[model samples]
Target: MVDEFLKWYFSQRPVLASQLGADGHDHTLGDFSAAGLTAREREEECWLDRLSRTETPTLDDAIDRDLVLSHLRGSIAMQSWPEWRRDPSAYLGPVFASMFNPFQQRLKPEPELVAAAISRLAEVPAVLAACRANLDPDLAAPLLVQRGLGQARTGRNFLTRTVPSMVEDPDLRARLAAAAEPAAAAFDDLVTFLEGFTCGGTWRMGEKLYSTLLRERELLGYGAAELHEKGRAAWAELDARMREVALRVNGTQDWRAAMETLMDDHPPTLEDMRAEYEAETLRARDFVRERELVTFPEGEECQVLPSAEYARPILAVAHYLAPPPLSSSRTGVFFVPYTPDGFTPEQVRQRLRTNCRAQMPSIAVHEAYPGHHWHLSYLAAGSRTARKVFRTPYFTEGWALYVEKMLHEQGYFDTPATELAHLDCRIFRAARIVVDTALHCEDMSIEQAEEFMATRASLSPGTAQGEVNRYCAWPTQAPSYLTGAIEIERIKESFTGTPREFHDRIAGSGGLPLGLAEQAALA
Candidate 1:
């Protein structure tokens, strides 16, 4: 029943590194059966049309025709995908082009969705320009240019999607009279995607044609609301646990005071802060490798890079970018963002040193080392179809979150300050539950959400605002972090008699969902 072409498309990898199997293991996502198509004759005979027209789960009403188009675009771009190792330019080109494909443009957005997307799109150039001028890094000029080009294309797509959405929304019709530049730029990403990415199946237009994308390419089964609710429950539990940790760290009767004390630590200079984070991340990598805790594909390496402008806003303060491609490159990047003196050294130092619940080490574990980069490498090396078609954010993110808590309970950090940072990270994520749920489900205004983040999560104004917009663009993603982490913890606890070994068995589960995690836990 799985679309056959989609399976082949995912298997090919990118020009950057399609052939570069992880540490010599040929782990293409196709290796696992993306469409669950195992029959040799069927797999060999299927073309894009037959594959694309395959039935899929019903899309939510809120999703417009354009949005569905975007899914089609993804499917199209994915076909003949270049492995990053084999061709970087091709990889970047196709990825960016996919953004425009009239694929995924929403047909009927609420007025607020239109308004917010517009407002944020306007800020892109300004925010990005500042980052480009100020941030420093070691990546070559070619790479930076590639990133900038990708952003330019992405910016275009942002406009293509948002501008029309604005014109369509009754409320934004009045405001649309003014914002010309952003509106123009919005169409940029689309133009590129349309021109650059092409596949045979794109020749048709119909419900089946569009839905095939949602099914074949992404393998995403749920609707917007389903994902949203999943995030809500996750946020709640994380917040509850974070509060408990704050109380413990403060040794205080009141969690509110403990939170204040935790945030009061002075900030750090960009270099020192970046260095500090990088070191911690390295330690995490060593921990996982040293302990032989999980399967680490050889050959690929993780390196710290300065955060690129395109990813600066929503990406974490420090982020992990996978290597160019396994065949061509061995280095992964951890991008650290730079803000002004507002991010003081003292605060950075305190965060690094503090001992509290909802700590920072958990973050380091998740962001670096044996977390994002680690698992990404794990999946990238395999040539499994199901893995590519059915990858889950909850599965990967949950594992990352779990890594932090698992290390802590396992006593990876000797210093209480280090321990506290780990707890604080959890606390912050817990708070994401409230922030994401309130903003999305409760229809909390940006200002209201910002206030919630600042007051409840103990974030600064800049960070709080960032969280607000991130929730808008990403929707239910934030809550997944906590949900996945907590679920991992619960599963481990259920097997308390063998927590260490049980925890060690995590990677073996191979990024299964919580439903499967439960089975894995019991097993």
Candidate 2:
């Protein structure tokens, strides 16, 4: 039953299939039209019914069944919101991925990959037309529309310029270029649609649905109000810690001032900044091995690269993109953002300041090394399809955040500024939980959230705006980082084993929710 469901699921999500190195579906963009979604929902219901009735003979079988059930339930519950009907951004993700996965994952020969990309590109107009047909601008949130426009614009740039340059063979390049023109035009049409929208919809998910998602979908022990309170407490605790580290760094309790002082010592240019991050990635990997912090799977590798031009708007600083689990390559890309083409001088300064030297060590540890790349590598090697495909964001995001603090305690962060930077990051995540809940459940406006982030998290105004825009679009995701770390720490407190054993146990659990992962770890 599980196998049947997964096959159907992957069949309907070709973009996902491509990303996971699954072939045979790369030439198509899965259905997004109204009739298509209705058909999908009907099929989903059928699968859920069959899976619920199926019998499992062993403990492992039962666990797998439960995982599939959880994933199905979450998908059904979220269907109530009808994201495709309201958010234009909903369509952009798969649109971007359709080309991105085929281009990046070298699973096939270059010509074949380019052929797949061209096919997907040809489908772009139809996909955008479906987006227009399904989306009700009256139900769209203004901020969501605005951000979707930004993404559309950059996506157009990526297809026209970056994608063609990536092709080496002249024949394939010509084919890709021809296909890209219509695809780029599709993005422009999307941009026009979004710009014309006077979206009046509320971004709020409301207290009831938000709480339900926190408890049911996220598999969390607490609801929105409790999570918000926890976030406030965590923020306060981290803020106090930051002040102490700040005093050590600059002889003052003004943590923001200390952060400014550290920012002044950043790399001279974006290229230099990328070099610094590369060095830190290698350095942290070595430190982890020397300290026996966690186990590394054989042949694991991570490469630091500039952020893709299309993703820089949302990827304000740096992030990790895990390698395809089904691919032979174990290399993950760590993307560092560069200043965009039209950024004002001040905007460029903010972009550079956010990636400054003092923060690089902690960022490197969180996004690469024993954080995301290292943890995900273990799962890629050994996890079942159920675990690999169905992820709990808190566990994934939290584990990354957890390693930052864990390594700090292990003396990996040798400088006071680095420690200060780690604490500031913690505070930032904590603030995310607070701001996220406030925006979705407590009726905080976008402007207020941006202000809160800029002042409390010590983010630049532009960075704060981008962060808030993300929070608006993705309801519970922002809170996952800090909340996940907090949950993992709680789980650690109950373990009697060495740190490495505990870390390895949790890392090996794939993307299970914290509650399930804790049971697996402590059992």
Candidate 3:
């Protein structure tokens, strides 16, 4: 049915016709062949290439208008819904992505746009410098020129360029401007949001579009209190079980010491880390193929790559590949950081310990098993273009969260101490859920949120507060980690029969939405 609709839509829309102007500003498919086509060419070609492979039978104008309008309506409806009673801190995530992910701000010549943006080789350095400086009027402050990103001149300039493209119609403009007031007012409530980094640049003020964004990022329509409660209950259970296992593994010794001893017994050298990763990737591939766990189409293969700079920070422990363009054959990359400061000789040597060895297997499962790495690979294999192009954060983060603790029972983290670390992460994520709810809707202070995380999760004060700051700046995201995990857990437990059958049940079908994860497991 969808394919039939798509075919009809394609004929009506004639995306190619829309691109060409009536004045016959001739866009020669081959005329400027040597100089290469412009930016418009690249975008058109990218879309065309994707469409050509769709296997849709026909193209109709009604379908074209419907597709474009449907997407646009989804956007405008979020902003204009009256008495929507939505949260303010959750708005405009995709809007944020469009602004930050690449360059689209300025009127660059067609050929240089996306490439210029991705390289970050444009005047971004100057912009970063300016944003970090002690300027007279901060970008966070309300002003006529506050239409872009931060201090980075190029970043801000690019944001300005990109935003207009998403929202340009005059009627929609008047409605957006009118609806924006409440959201902007909500921003004033999140004071720490403005005092972002030590360098004086402001974080993205996406909290202004909080309501719609929250709905979009989170798959369900649940309230904050419900999410907070679910996370807290799950954390409590995981913590109790972890400590019990820790004591047993140490033969009644203290939990912390047991952890240290275990890590020392199974530590890996720096070189071993690389070899082990390659070994695991192959092992995972074999398991999927043998079990038929979501088939990867013939000729499709997943690859691993070294981490990049912007990604390196968050993925200090683990990372994965960025989506390649349609024409590219680059497989997904799984990256592990090798920072000398972080991975000292002593630290690397610790992996030789037995307990540490036990830990590596669980980490492997979290990174490569039925976890995100495999889930995404499955998605790509099934060719779910809409889900691929637009994935909800709840689903993405939830799948990863589910995989983290689930590895414990999978025979990966056998010893108790290593298991403690897994539980600790779960605890930290749980605290984030509470903090995410209280921080925004309940209007908790930074110190209060930090205190809650530190006490409940056993996190250092610095780590807790850093998390708090992230919540203040990012909003609603803190819950995604644990929220996703718990939902996955619920789905797993809801199964009526053996866990093996559960595994086989989900083997063929690709990733499912959180709302249906439980139902799918039962089916």
The TM-score leader among the candidates is: 2
- Tens-place lDDT per residue, model 3, 104-198, is 12223333333322222222232223322323243332221221222122222224333223344555434434433332333332222324422
After superposition, the stretches of candidate 2 with alpha carbons farther than 4 Å from their true spots are none
lDDT of 1 by residue, 432-489 (tens): 7656655545456678888877776556666677666656544445666766776676
Report how far off residue 472 is in candidate 1 (Å).
0.7
Which candidate achieves the best lDDT against the true structure? 2
**Residue 498 of model 2, lDDT score:** 88
The TM-scores of all predictions, comma-separated, are 0.55, 0.97, 0.56
True-structure lDDT of candidate 1:
0.48
Name the candidate, 2 or 3, with the larger lDDT value. 2
Q: Write the per-residue lDDT of candidate 2 for residues 3-79, one digit (tens) a residue.
A: 77778989999888778766577888888899999789878878889999999996556667777777777777777
In candidate 1 the C-alpha lDDT for residue 311 amounts to 50
Question: Which TM-score value belongs to model 2?
Answer: 0.97
Clashes of each: 81, 0, 38
True lDDT of residue 155, candidate 3: 23
